[model samples]
Target: MNDTGRQSRHLGIHIDRTVGEVYAYASDPANLPAWAHGLGGSMERVGDRWVAESSPMGRIEVAFVPRNELGVLDHHVTLPSGETVHNPVRVIADGAGSEVVFTVRRQPGTSDADFERDASAVAADLARLKEVLEFD
Candidate 1:
C-alpha cells in the first residue's frame, strides 16, 4: 500500500524469452484478447484511441505508451463509468529470460479481497502470456 492508503501492487512473471520478444507481443493492442481477460474479447483502433469490449463494463478505452526499447508498457484504461486507471507495466531482461510486471492500482473504496482478486487476475494473465510466448 502507498502513502495514500491505496492497494497498489506489482504482479509479474519471468518468461523464458528475450525482452524484445516479450515486449513485442505484450505491447501490441491487438494481442490483448489473448491475455488481458479483464479487458474483454476484442479490441480495435478508433481514430487515435483503442477501444475494447469489456464484458460487464461495456466498451472501454485504452492507451499505451509509445514503442520504446526501454521495455515500458505503461497504459491507461478508461472504464465505462468514465474512470481512468493508469497501469504501469514493464518488460525487463532477467538472466536467460525476461520479467514482465504489471502494476494494479487500488480503485476507490476497493475491499481487501477485491484487491487480492485483481492481483490474482494479473498473475493469471502473465501465466497465459508465458504459455503463449514460450511454446516449444
Candidate 2:
C-alpha cells in the first residue's frame, strides 16, 4: 500500500574481500549454484551461454555481463516460459572490503509479503557468497 515499497527493492551484503576478488568469483556463471540456492544445479556452458536446470524455474539460460574490472555482474535469465528477467548486480569496494548488491523487481501485482520474501532470499544468497569467499 505504500509507494516506497511498491515495485522494486535493492538488497546486498558486505564481504570481507576486495572488489575485484568478489567480482571475479561472483561473475563466473559456474559459481551460481554455490551461492544462489534458487538456481541449485551444475550450470554448463553451451557455446557462449550458461544453462541450468534451476530448482524452481526449470531449465533456464543465463548470460552474464562480459567480464570487467569495474565489478559489474549484471545478468539475464531466460525461463522455460520464455520470460526473460534482467538482474542488476554489482560489487563495489567499501574501504578494505566489498559490498555486493542485487536488485529484486517486484513483478506487477506482487503482494507485499511476496516482495519481502524475495528480498530475504536475495539477502541469504549474498550471505552465502560472503561465507564462501570468506572461508576460502
lDDT score for residue 66 of model 2: 95
> In model 2, which runs have C-alpha deviations exceeding 4 angstroms?
1-6
* Decoy 2 TM-score against native: 0.90
Query: Candidate 2's residue-wise lDDT over 36-87, tens digit each?
Result: 9877578999988899876577998899989987788999988888988888
Error of 2 at 21 (Å): 0.8
Question: Per-residue lDDT for 122 in model 2?
Answer: 86
Per-candidate Cα lDDT values, in order, are 0.87, 0.86
Which candidate number maximizes TM-score? 1
Please provide, for model 1 over 78-117, each residue's C-alpha lDDT reduced to its tens digit, 9 standing for 90 to 100. Answer: 8999989899999999998999989888887777888888
